[model samples]
Target: MKLAVIGAGAVGSSVVELASDHGHSVTAFADSSSAVIDSAGVDTAAVLDRKRTDGVVGGGAPEDALSAEYDVLVEATPTTLGDAEPGFGHIQAALERDRHAVLANKGPVAERYADVRALERESEGSVLFEATVGGAMPILSTIDDFDPSHITAVRGVLNGTANFILSRMATEGLDYEHVLAEAQDLGVAEADPTFDVDGTDAALKGVIIANVLSDDETEYTLDDAEVTGIQEISGSALELARADGRTVRLIAEVVEGSVRVGPRLVPDNAPLAVSGTRNIAQLETEHAGQLNISGRGAGGPETASAVLADIGRL
Candidate 1:
């Protein structure tokens, strides 16, 4: 497939490298850093180095790059749901041109899932976003297999950074700040880290999952959901978990019409107890019972693998 990658950050760069490795022709790479985008098809290693040096990151504007025709357009930019002009505009342009879209970015889908779905219907094109939720894990596809009416409840540790921090707090007795710094050093947390540390990241994932689990394509809102960041928790919470043979994890759940995202003390025997850095998600349904998925939650190679899988579907 001829593809266009609309970001050159960690995920986008990984997509470009993986697609190119799979023998797919990467038509254009759009990023603020012209040097990085230009070097996408040439020297990926150097492009990564330049990105590190320049810090000109996030999803690149797709205005100019989308003008060129391509079979598929992959959106891997950093998410900001409220404003979709540049990002959503690029996806719309691809669909308008009858090109398939594979999105790894959550912003467009989280804020405008209904509109984007309608656009896909009108354009007769597909928008696959397996990487958006669980990195390479196939949570979305599993939900797609069953009838929405059969789904009873959805719950899991949706944010890996929070999970990792909690896990470290339990194991090493480290405070939130220390574990967060460790996560950043390990590349699990972004430099800003607000989305992961706070519950916003998990809340967005809940919105997407709720949409998939709902019978109707009703617009899901994050307003009613209770969200709390792991930062609010003290190291003493981890100590309490140890006293009770438990560990704290940032859990998110969508049951009926209500959704909740917050840090919870999970029993030692719980599946969440086994979840490590960037891993874990579970879906419970009337028919399917309980299905669990766990893997590297955030990483270039894992996310890139998902983009490649979507490209294969095209």
Candidate 2:
């Protein structure tokens, strides 16, 4: 597939760098302000080098890549709530042109599921977003394979930043602020760290999962989720949980048309009590009993791999 990638961030750049390895060509690439286009294929290395050195993907307007030659639009833009602008609009442009849309951005699917599906219904293209829920984890694809009806519920640690902090606190008896500072220094947590630490990122993933499981019977948005952050989780709480043979994880649970994300207690030996920056998702199934899927849940190359897998599906 020929891919047009928007957003020159880590995930976008990874997709551009790895597209050829996945048997796809990125025909156009864009950042927030600029773009590079070619009917044949964009020079991936040159474009990425320019982005590294000059801080822009190319010289053209960002919107130009939306109209460039491509079989699929890889929407890797920064995720936004509410309107989910630019990302939603980019998906709209692709579907309007009858081109497939493979998303790494969770905004459109999480916040505007019905709108995206409505557009897909009228277009010849289909939308797949395996990268949105768990980076490189194949969470959505597995759910689709099992058939959403067969899956009873989905719950686990969906945010690596929050999980790392909790894990460090529980294991080392470090305070919340200290562990968070270590995480930020280690690049596990962002400078702001609001979304990942505040449960918004995990909630967005839960909302997307809920939207998928709904199968169009219901539409889910951030407003529908009950979100609780880990900001107030002190080391003493983790100590208490540890004394009880349990650990705290920022779990996102989606079941029976509801989505909830917050810190939850899990047994120390439980699969959900994964350490460091790893992520785990437990799927309750009707026939299969329980299924555990775990791996690196966030990173550029990790997420880009998922995005490329979605493109291959398209």
* Highest TM-score model number: 2
Local accuracy of candidate 2 as per-residue lDDT tens digits, 234-272: 889999999999999999999899999999999999999
lDDT of 1 by residue, 1-314 (tens): 77777877778888877776887867666775442233234355544565678764323444556775468888877777675556787789889988999988887777787788888888967888888887888788777776667777778887778888888878888888888888899887779999888898898888878877763457675655689988888888779878999888888888886778988888988887755676678878787579888887777788888888878867
* TM-scores vs. true structure, each candidate: 0.89, 0.99
Give the Å error, residue 246, model 1. 1.2
Error of 2 at 218 (Å): 0.7
Error of 2 at 312 (Å): 0.8
Note the Cα lDDT for every prediction shown: 0.77, 0.94
Candidate 1 error regions (>4 Å): 33-62
CA-only RMSD, every prediction: 3.2, 0.7
The ten-residue window of minimal lDDT in model 1 covers 33-42
